[model samples]
Target: MDKERLPRWGWLLAGLFVAALVANLLNLFVLVPTVFPEEYRAVTVITTMSPVLIYVGVWYDEHRQHYWEQSGAHIAGDVLFVVTGAALGSAIVLVAIIDFGIPAFLREVLAMGAGFLMSWGLFWWRNPDVYADESAR
Candidate 1:
């Protein structure tokens, strides 16, 4: 893939990651306190899991068609992408908050955006044909 086109996927993935981060943040900061109120145990569980479900669903939707090969290696690589991206993104946010005194919200947004870009780049590099239609750009 051309270096110039790489930014397109970077931005796209960053946007998705930020959306996931925002959903999770909203659940923690607002929905849990106001909408779900801790008094209801089932509501709490639902609220806690909703953001994760949303993120996974969105991620799968974004890649499902491109990665429909169903090969073991493809599945394993996709899983690795999720695990590594989440781990690295969390670490980045934690370090920024603790060491730089950045707000958690800002750190999370930045970390997830960067994580998605990096992870997507790796994924795209591994599967160049996924975005073979450069002419569409």
Candidate 2:
């Protein structure tokens, strides 16, 4: 019999790493010099969309149907929407900081990072049991 490739929680950690890496790469290469001011749209879009796309590769193993049957997609979607709220909240604070003379690029980066961390942390905090191993199902 085939075994589960990774512990359930591993998937989330992997997704987080991938999302962060991709965002950083975009910042270092494509997003920084774009016409948009300080990469604002790039940062916000990455922060908001990562959750929805996090599981793209995990569906390949048909034998592990139980693992894929969780409400993870729904939960991921919930986390995705919270991203908008987080970004908006961070923007309000960033706006106030702007009056204090912070660099726009730095401010945008901070906002995106904070928003993503909040969403990721919230996902983990509220869903402790969501990633229980297949054996626990």
Candidate 3:
């Protein structure tokens, strides 16, 4: 990865985090407050889905080049990454709700954190050379 590309990747990660934060905020402040308590489950599903969707979209766009080179493995890895991230995030939310009795806002925050960590981990695993200097090329 070029030094120049590093900033782009950083910005992309930052944007994903910010988007997750905003989704959680909206879920906590607007959706939950305005909707019926019964619909809270639906709100939770939507908030959880948003980050995974963003991660998939960004990952696909960034790694499209590697798609053709290793189509089967790459696609499978992508699917696994999304599914694992979603499961991890959902588990965090469930645990927070059931075990900790944490508030909605804090639960959202934990979900976002889980999503961020999963996304970063997968991204790093997929792009191990991300920090390599590219000036020679």
Query: RMSD for each model, in Å, please?
Result: 10.5, 7.0, 7.6
Q: What residue pairs are clashing in model 3?
A: none
Give the Cα lDDT of each candidate.
0.51, 0.56, 0.55
Instruction: Give the per-residue lDDT of model 1 (tens digit) for 11-78.
Output: 45655566556656775888777774432222222222233433343344444354566698876775
Better model by lDDT, 1 or 2?
2
Error of 2 at 58 (Å): 7.3
Misplaced by over 4 Å in model 2 are 1-43, 52-67, 80-82, 130-137
Q: Report the lDDT tens digits of candidate 3 across residue range 20-115.
A: 576567767876678635323433543445445544444445543443465688756755675566556655555557456777776656665665
75 in model 2: Cα distance from truth in Å? 3.2
- In model 2, what is the error at residue 34, expressed in angstroms? 20
Q: What is the lDDT of residue 116 in candidate 2?
A: 56
Candidate 1 wrongly placed segments (more than 4 Å): 1-66, 134-137
- How big is the positional error of residue 83 in model 1, measured in Å on the Cα after superposition? 2.2
Quote model 1's TM-score: 0.46
- Using lDDT, give the best candidate's number: 2
Clash count, one per candidate: 0, 0, 0
Clash-forming residue pairs, model 2:
none
